[model samples]
Target: MDTTTYPAPQHRTATTTAPPPRGPAATFALHLGAMAVAMLLGMLLLAPVATALADAAGWDQAAAGPEAEALVMAATMTLGMAVWMVHRGHGPRAVGEMTAAMVLPFAMGLAPYWAGLVSAADALVVGHVLMLPAMVGAMLLRRSEYTGGHAHIRARTAWGRAVEAVAHRWPTLLALGLTFDSWLRPGIPPAWTLLLLGAEYLVIGAVRREFHRDRLLAAHIAGFVLYLGLAAVAATTPATVAGPVIAAAWILHIAWDAALHRADRVTWRWYAEACAVIDLVVGVTVLLAL
Candidate 1:
């Protein structure tokens, strides 16, 4: 055997050539069409879904008034745009800018309404109209990225992967939380609402067939008893006591969500994560009575 050690030959590395730019005009038209679809979904499809969910959940979406309704509409539009953009293989930064553009007009309009400077109707109309220009501005900010015809589906870093996961999987849960966060502002939750918690716990556990596990069984029974006790307290006690009790229950449920999440036992991790966030929102809303 030859004793001389030769250095290993370097392998040829392949280089990726980016595709030609789509040009601003093509990019703008594509985004404009996306906006149109988003607008259509917001007004005609998703808004009604939010309203129906609110109705079914005894949330009384109207009681949140016009500003909240406008925000919900904005959120729905953002959701539609986000889903469509991801489906179109757009990059996260570009998608984020588009989402911000969709929501900014609503936020701007809401400010004047909150300050009593503008009527809700005018604010809403202005917000809707302003959204188009805001979107144009966002596209301008990412001119190169948006106008480029190169594949937008670049390899993601760990942070980018995490962001894309949230942007894709968690929007609906966030929207649902927004839709119902106002539920506690009016008064104590309805009797059915409190009872529903118990049912929800049982169903969530049963679906996993995890009730056969001793620890899970004990946990579910404890949760049922706690919910039942809360329902009783809410029914018989004064609002002063009931509100805090209900709020505490909601906050406590976050712990339940955590346990299930860590064990990866009951529901999908996304549901657990989203439920924790929603629970915290409702809990704080009840505590503040806002």
Candidate 2:
């Protein structure tokens, strides 16, 4: 993911910037238990809808079944995880863990369904349905961060608010523009999509120049180079290869966006969330189209 204000890559402990600790064991248990329940629910609900969509779209089960199933699994997981991250106070530490959950069903469970060895219901149920409780819990915890809610999670700081504000503005529209292009055109190469992301970085960097000069430049420079390199890589890679790369880059982009805002390097914090969502939708669209 291209980022204008990326964090210096570093190790972050699980408790680093999270709201008041529930203790390592307790925190882990909370997400695990809640996610399990949520997954169960989401599976029951999404499975039927997915089947209907697949039928209506005239999906070739034997041919594009894996891709379709994977798409469904990944989209649901991404949405659930992103929602969880937001409600969870947009905590940096929890983002990776939650994001990781998005892949479990796509990589493992969906394969069995493609092979006719498992039902879509079973696969999706095991994939991200549990994300419902996870998001609900996180949202409730972070509610205090906003209006009426619990007191465990702290409200965002002044810098955090600013970063959110900035991110919610143009960056979001930028993602939407890219997404619309991808949807409408359907054949724009990954290189072009990524190059646009580089352009976005330039715009963000330019915006940040008005503030702290030193901290923003190095990251922006690195991000520009990285995005271009990725574009080159995507240009040569097959869709099978490029799809994952693009999806991963988008996920990483979402994470870095959060990290930046959390570090107060951003003025508004909404861009990361928007980017994550659009990336998820766009990434799946590309995967399926391919």
lDDT scores in order? 0.72, 0.55
RMSD of 1: 10.9
Candidate that would win on TM-score = 1
How many clashing pairs per prediction, in order?
0, 18
Clashing pairs in 1: none
- Model 1 clash number: 0
- Candidate 2: tens digits of C-alpha lDDT, residues 44-81: 44555566566668975446645566676565445444
- lDDT, model 2, position 31: 56
Per-model TM against the reference: 0.50, 0.35
lDDT, residue 76, model 2: 48
lDDT for 42 in candidate 1 is 52
RMSD of each: 10.9, 16.7
lDDT comparing candidate 2 with the true structure: 0.55
Model 1 lDDT tens row, 1-290 = 88999999975433233554466688667767866675565555467677767887889877778877887888888877776676455777777888888888988987888899988888888889899899888877777656665355643588766655655654354545454535534344554466766667678878777678587788788788878888898888887888888888888888987787788886777677777776777777777772
